[model samples]
Target: MNIDSMIDESRIDDMMENELIGFISTDMSDEEVLAFIDELEAEEDAREELFDHFAN
Candidate 1:
């Protein structure tokens, strides 16, 4: 069998969707996100957008 056939794509998709929802809803706070971005040294525009996203 092919490697692709051995993987369950639907199950992976469901798990990824659930993780994204959890991450956006409750995993990280605004402060944490900002700290993370700071650690990464993200660009000004990207940081601004990310800050706005967490604010709302």
Candidate 2:
């Protein structure tokens, strides 16, 4: 079995869609939105690092 094929693209899509929906529905200022996005990026980076550590 291919490891790449085991990853669920649809789940990622759903998670991103949920985040976008939350962002659109909020009344945050531009700076706040930028900060929120940066936070999300940081969390995603951490998750990727953890996954890589376990994968290796």
Candidate 3:
């Protein structure tokens, strides 16, 4: 919900949409890509929890 969180989420979305690591290849399967996405979501959740503690 904060601007930085929004930006971070947008960046993750863009990375998945890119379909290329650099300028060449995208050999990853949908499952791998989704797993990576889950990792990002977990990270975001951790950060939000930390922020919530700090806010309190």
Best by the TM-score measure: 2
Tens-digit per-residue lDDT, 8-53, candidate 3: 6687567645633442337777787777767766766786688668
C-alpha TM-scores of all predictions: 0.33, 0.67, 0.56
Who is ahead in TM-score, 2 or 3? 2
What would the per-residue lDDT of candidate 2 be over residues 1-56, giving only the tens digit for each residue? 46573464455546766896777545778888788777777776676678668878
Candidate 2 global CA lDDT score: 0.68
Reference-based lDDT, each prediction: 0.54, 0.68, 0.66
Per-residue lDDT, model 2, residue 10, is 50
Minimal lDDT window, size 10, model 3: 16-25
User: 1-56 in candidate 1: lDDT tens per residue?
Assistant: 44653354445446555654555545689897566545444444455577558756
Off by over 4 Å in 1: 1-7, 25-56
> RMSDs, each prediction?
14.3, 3.2, 4.8
